[model samples]
Target: CFYLLFNSVLFSVLSDVELRSYRWLQTMIFTVEEINRNPVLLPNLTLGYLATDTCLSEGSTLSAALSIVTGQDKAVTEQCTKAPNVSLFPFFFCAPHLQVSYFASCACLSDRTRYPTFLRTVPSDAFQAQAMARLLRQMGWSWVGVIYGDDAYGKSGVQLLIQELEGSGVCVDYTEVIPKSHALEKIKRIVERIQSSKAQVVVTFAISPDIEVLLKEVVRQNATDRQWIATEAWSTSTHYSAWSGISLVGTLGFALRRVDIQGLGSYLTQLSPEEHTNEQLVQNVWEEVFGCKFGKEMYSGPHCTGLEKVEVQGEAYFDVMYNVYKAVYAIANAIQDIFFFLPTYIKYGQSKKLISGVKFTTPVGELVHFDNNGDPSASYDIINWHMGAEGKVEFVKVGQFDAARGPQQDFQLDLINMENRLYIIQVPVSVCSESCPPGTRKAVQKGKPVCCYDCIPCATGEISNANSRECTKCLERFWSNTDRTECIPMLVEFLSFQDIMGIILSVLSIAGATLTGTVLTAFFYHRDTPLVRGNNSELSFLLLLSLKLCFLCALAFIGRPAPWSCMLRHSLFGISFVVCLACVLSKTVVVLVAFRETLPGSNIMRYFGPAQQRAGIFVCTLVQVLICVLWLVLAPPLPTESAGGELGARVVLLCAVGSVIGFSLVLGYIGLLAAICFLLAFFARKLPDNFNEAKFITFSMLIFCAVWIAFVPAYVSSPGKYTVAVEVFAILASSYGLLLCIFAPKCYIILLKPEKNTKKSMMAK
Candidate 1:
């Protein structure tokens, strides 16, 4: 019978030795021992447990625990429906008020899936953040900087602090991101940035590594004049000596600990003799069990061994843990006796549910019964780490608060002044002065008070409204009048000579593109020369058509808004420039290939077979199509409303052909092609060959590519009328390349060699 019971037990509580600090393992061990001794309605059975040494370094111990618990299944069914009891219980002893995510992966929180079963002993992390905010507000610190690790812990803490601060009329002066690895170089950079920010109070969501790096850097840089605050990770025995030794002594830290005596007594009464021993107590427990000495053994960071009030201001941390233990027992008791877990409607009628409501009176106050979410009606302790009269490290419970109330009402307590402590520093409160008056800006800081500063009224072209910090500039259609006192419309008078200049330029660009396209077409169809040969002619014609389109589009882009003008501007401006650029690129590649083929032993020439050349043309055209498609997808066609009504409705929806990256790449590709083409043409020109027209084509493309490349900077930087001027320049430059490259030679032969043309014509007649 003894062997059967022993083997049936899944856990064995061999020795229950509670250190001053009840870590996750110790908490579990204590609970198991208490349950075994009391025989909580179990069918004549007891459990044993074996405790081993584990480090608190990261997730090492959690990984070990998960491995040990694998494949061990001893079913302990509470309800008759037969769910495994061990599996049913997901979690136990959580720091409920500690909502910040720093210790999310610790062994204590290894099983998140079992969260419902996992009971939290303390409040959520939000509770701690809210408490800190209230404390800051009470102290009248309006502006603060936060330096947190770049992880879930730091981010969540920052969010809570931000929420708390914003409501209290405080603004975040700076937010610093510190990596978990705590690289000294990275920390040094962050520290330097923080020092330059001129922040008075620094709140840190850092682990020990981050803290050590930050503190060392702060002290080294003499940036220790400001205050330092910490989160829960430093609330254990590990940080006490190191923190005390550091130049930073008066720094405030936030963590969860059980200091309720009523809860502690209830917990002890329920435990077995082994669990109830001196080892199981808070400070007293550690010295007896481990035979290791600590100066003032405290549960959380800020309490001590003696009742000097100088060391520990309040009750021990045993109280908080004890309250948690009582809550668990109450919940378990209700589930067994009254079967209070049974619901009104059930699949199996009249069967008890796994969970039940719990209510308990804790030492702090009334810890009301929990609802389904396991929300406890409890408050949090605000503790401080300070050096005592004995010159030893100690924690003191300075204040406590309830987070359930409204922002203004929550955590209202007198702050314990720790100005004498080493880590804490007194900082002057910052005031967010009222914004400069509507008509002026902060005028040369006339003195200390904000209202004493001077102000300047808005200029004639600008107007200001209430609640606006600065004046608004007027539109381009109107300008300030001569008086410089008020704005008036810009009077327009019909001008005849200005119109003549615009007409002449428009006609010239159109004539050049049209005559060039016509001449190139005639040469391709009628001439026997190889200059007229090759598939490059089709691409040349496309370039010619795109150039003509640009000329027409520019003409359409004149005057105030019109729908027809808007559509033409977007379609022709974006489409024509792209296609023309593509054609120039194709011509450059052709010239490079021709030179390569002429070279003695160049395999590069072989790569550009007819198929490859055709593929190249297809790729270039496809790139232009993709650019248009991107514009269609990203920039919606729907016209945005304007301040000026119907006249402004017609917005020029010119598609930005490429983003900066795309723009740079396209330009680079064209530049590279042009460079190769010109280099080859230069060498080819040295041979005083007949009709060296390829040289003109090569040099023309080099000039064209350089012009387009330079256009990017000019077009991007140009403002107002200058932008229109640049667009017109681009239109002329792109179209003229085709005229110069394809039609110039034919034009020269026709006009310069007139006698040869006439003689050929007479002979044909």
Candidate 2:
């Protein structure tokens, strides 16, 4: 079989060192098994296998194969070239570790004149250099010392690295290129030169074989104190453990490891078993050749049963090459499809026409045909290797580079959407520091590259999401009444003792006024006889009536309940006060008239009568009613529910025009009445005993008006307790004034004058 000879040349070396790390091999094997089980497209075609010992003796067999391919002339090379129209280079598939000499040698051999069939799976050296430059630019590393292997790999890496660094605003302090094959001695020399140069950080690019040798030399030379940085390649055991005394270890290249094989086998088993005929047949052939079971020991690595028993599996040897094998098979299938189908598929039926429709699925994912200039028209994976257990290694997938997406802002591959790829377990550098900005989030989409998502701020009292358009409202305790632009200190309700005191004082004032009113009414009507027949005692009676009314009105507002209650209560009480005030005014007018008429000959005052006094009362009372009507019509009260459903609504019980009218009218009338009483008192200062009552009436009015007027401001301005006290005092003063004015003189005359009593007794005898 074509595969038998391929296997012999491929597996030139088979040992535990190569077989121990089965990750990459396992991934490849699973992919092949899946493909073999599901050969739907090529139903009749059988898959085959080949293995190689490229890792043997530092990959000498690989180098020999590359050299043979590179030694060819242009004509011979063209014969092996896959396709001229393909964008990616000559090799069908290639993976290079970027080891200084090896990479350079491989790149050199890949020249169009040398080997047209060579193609690379990893990024070109230029890409790596650009990435390094980007990292340095971000870090603000102004200068660095470059120490590299003097061979092809190191030289090429350094050139690209320098070019990228220079383009991105970094200055190389000095470059020290060392020979790749000189081993530990070369490292010592470079370390000494780097130390003398005083570079802050050293960038080294070398193969594993050379890294260990150089690290030992650097320690011996006492240059291990120097800070050193490198790409992910240096994370290998050769460089990691070998670098003895370095104070710092940091990397700038792709750094990641491990692929999750969870659930991989079960997923592949679902593929059709009949399609896996070729794989099974090949396994059977190998089993017969090796004189052991095919899948048990050959497919899986050796498992130790006892002290002397070791199960050797063929898969352990060549399974890691599954990806490579699939890549070859895919190419073969494409070639066959292109050659056989083009004849019928193409318009002119030409088999030699450019095979642009070629495509295939590989272990990694999908592989589409290339475009011109050896540039892959399909997606590519970026990966890095890290040192693992027992001197083994692991591969970490970073991100995918898709040309279909837009390029990076800095003209590099945009890793924006690739931040969440399975390869990059850690967050990407581009988004980590600045977190998708204020209006964005990490988001990925198929077909088009997903940029960060946008976060929409909420409206008033609402909260916004970090990565979405959704928003929510704030809780009641954390009220943001306005837009969520800011959060403010919340408002809370707290009833103070002072407020309650005000209300309580107000209640006492009202009760005292009511009591005074009851007393006044009782004195006026409870008696079987009239207290006054004309304006003589009319003034005293009216004054008492007015004080009682005022007290009652004050009582209405004592509680300070709802605004509506204040409005209604104030209206009713105001009207009552006005009527009582009218009575006082009428009495004052009568007194003024009586005093004027009693004067020698004042014709203008001669029209004084009880009818006139009664008429005055009616006029004043009517005017007071009109004022109350105006107040009610102009301003209405609000209900309690509007202000957040609380009993206290944000209503204006602030006694607007109505209160002003009530107070002004009552006070104005009282002032006028007091002035008239004062004038009477002054004129009748020396009159008869019954008429001396005018002086007392004047004094009582003055006290009543003054006290109540003072209470006005306290009642209107003071909020809670003091206001209540002021109101109570005002009511007491007015009530006592009225009571004294009406009965004080009469009580003195009746109780203290025994002569008048005796005289009346003698007249009766």
RMSD to the true structure for each prediction, in A, is: 23.3, 15.2
TM-score per candidate, in order? 0.40, 0.45
Put down candidate 1 lDDT per residue, 474-558, tens digits, no spaces: 5755544333333445543211125453455567666766775677566556444343433255665665676667666666444
Stretches of model 1 off by over 4 angstroms after superposition:
1-118, 207-213, 216-223, 235-238, 241-243, 257-368, 404-408, 416-424, 427-765
Candidate 2, residue 733: the lDDT equals: 68
Q: Global lDDT of each model? A: 0.49, 0.44
| Per-residue lDDT over 1-765 for candidate 2, one digit per residue giving the tens place of the 0 to 100 score | 011001111121111121222223333455445545655644555444322333323333344335434642111100111101111121222322111111122234335334333333333555556556665555445456777765556677787787666445356667876553454456566777777753455666654334445655666666644445554334333223433422222222342222233355344323332344554433332332334453365546543221222233321222223333444444444545754775586677542233334456544454534332222332333333333344333333434434455556332322453233222133222221122222233343343222223334445445444433345555544544343443444443222224565555556556756665665564455232322333345544565666666665665544434556546654565555555555555555555555456556566654555577667767766766675566556654322211111222122223233445554664565456556555655555544434345566567667767776677777777543344346455655666675567456554434465344333332342
Q: Which residue runs of candidate 2 sit more than 4 Å off their true CA positions? A: 1-333, 341-503, 518-522, 525-543, 558-567, 598-606, 640-765
The 10 consecutive residues of candidate 2 with the worst lDDT sum are 75-84
Name the Cα RMSD for model 1: 23.3
